[model samples]
Target: MGKADPKESYALGTAGRGLDPRAERSRAAALAAASDLLIENGWAGVTHASVAARSGVGRTTLYRHWPEAAMLIQQLLAELFQVEPVERTGELRADLIGELRSFLRVLHNPKSERALRVIIDQAPLDPRYAEVLSACSCKGTDGLREIVDEAKARGGLPKELDTDVAIDHLLGPLVFRRLISGQEFPDQYVPELVDSFLEPLTP
Candidate 1:
């Protein structure tokens, strides 16, 4: 067989320019297809070929954009978890509660929970997945850090406590209970966790 033309391959799936309605539609279709595949099959089943087949987009189109399943899944998470930043209400207790509740909501979703478990389980096998998960954690941790900083600024945190460690102390129990024990995390537990951390912070 003769050599294939690289330019022809590239042009076959190229999205049109700005204000091009067809290009916009194609982009939306690709994203939606990828997201549905993730929700349905979790991380392991979301290959670029599968996504392209599901989306009706050529493999070249999918490769030209995402190049990998992890990248596509990460993009999906970023879009789905685009929560509004926690507003500083000047009340440390309220702020902490609000932030934690928001995080819980994200984790409690069955789809999200399954996706997270898959990613965590697969990370050991795939370095790229591990990197994707780490990046996602950093993004999430930044939000938690803001809440902790706000609490400190408002005098709700212990003077000598380390913020990172304090965050673990505050939130770690809930994660452990849910992820390890496979128990439901009730809203009532929020106040208890907050109180446990707050008592030490208060003089």
Candidate 2:
């Protein structure tokens, strides 16, 4: 699969670009096909023409929206793993636990796990995919950073605390446990991770 062409830049939207339901469905179908192929056959299996065939969307429409297979894969990931807004419930501890739990839910899902593994394996070979993966990661990282910034602003955390490092500590263990160890990253693990990270920063 080739990288996204330098001449064409695709915006985040459906294939037809207008406010048409049919176009939206086609786009969703195409994305689902790409996601499935990536999960099942790895990055090499996903291509513009293959996705068009699998999705039953016309090649013209697929190419019109995503010319490159990498582009399709990137959009597929964006659709699958949406970066949600942080929920601040006026309680830092509760919010922290809630955020990590949401993360655990996604990481524990088999489909997402498969996609992540494919992305990780493909990153070294495909620079385009690496950029896409980094962008996706930034979405989650930025959301977590917002939570840390908000907590620090409210004096819940130490003023000098590094939000980036703080976020790494908060999410890193879950990633290790889920991806590295292949163990069940249970719900109960969320509280302990959140509390331990907060304890030192809190007081």
Candidate 3:
């Protein structure tokens, strides 16, 4: 039920250091157990007691580290959503296609997909989750921004175009296709969609 090789950086960062290896294992086990709990039971199912029972890491330890569901969720997200920055190939169409392909790969993983669903489900009702979600989002935003900036500098896109709107135009469809449609076409759909966007833009 847990992700294989749970990331210790997120745990170490959130809880602070100075723990023995055994203590680190206990913390990582708790986080992994909580992640499994989130996937299996969603937000409502995860509690300090539940995580303690699942991980056998003790309720007091869960309370000491996570303190609340939001904090625990924050730690989980920090580990799960490791969005990498996009590398530009100097071609707008190619860069965009690469971006979508990369994003789709992340979404293709069932564990990551479930984590996103949980965050999206909670962000509306909880400000803490919203904050964490925003942090994750900014990483994506930066990548798109870079692609757009590079495209504009190369005269691939109009100089006067609103970058924010452009980012939406570029990323919105792939996101919509995956999250809203609940459909995935990571291989065949990427290029067709990229071409569809660029056809109107090209002079």
Go through the candidates in order and give each one's C-alpha lDDT.
0.66, 0.74, 0.75
Candidate 1: give its CA RMSD in angstroms: 6.8
Question: Which candidate comes out best when scored by lDDT?
Answer: 3
Off by over 4 Å in 1: 1-21, 124-127
Going through the candidates in order, what is the number of backbone clashes in each? 0, 0, 0
lDDT of 2 by residue, 123-189 (tens): 7888765765686677667757777898889898887898888988999998898889878755578
Most TM-score-accurate candidate: 3
* Candidate numbers, best lDDT first, in rank order: 3, 2, 1
What TM-score does each of the candidates earn? 0.76, 0.80, 0.84
lDDT tens digits by residue: candidate 1, 45-79: 77888888888977786676566666666555544
**Model 3 regions lying over 4 Å from their true place:** 1-20
For candidate 3, lDDT tens digit of each residue in 87-156? 7787788888888777776676666667777778889988767876787677567777888777878899
The order by descending TM-score is 3, 2, 1
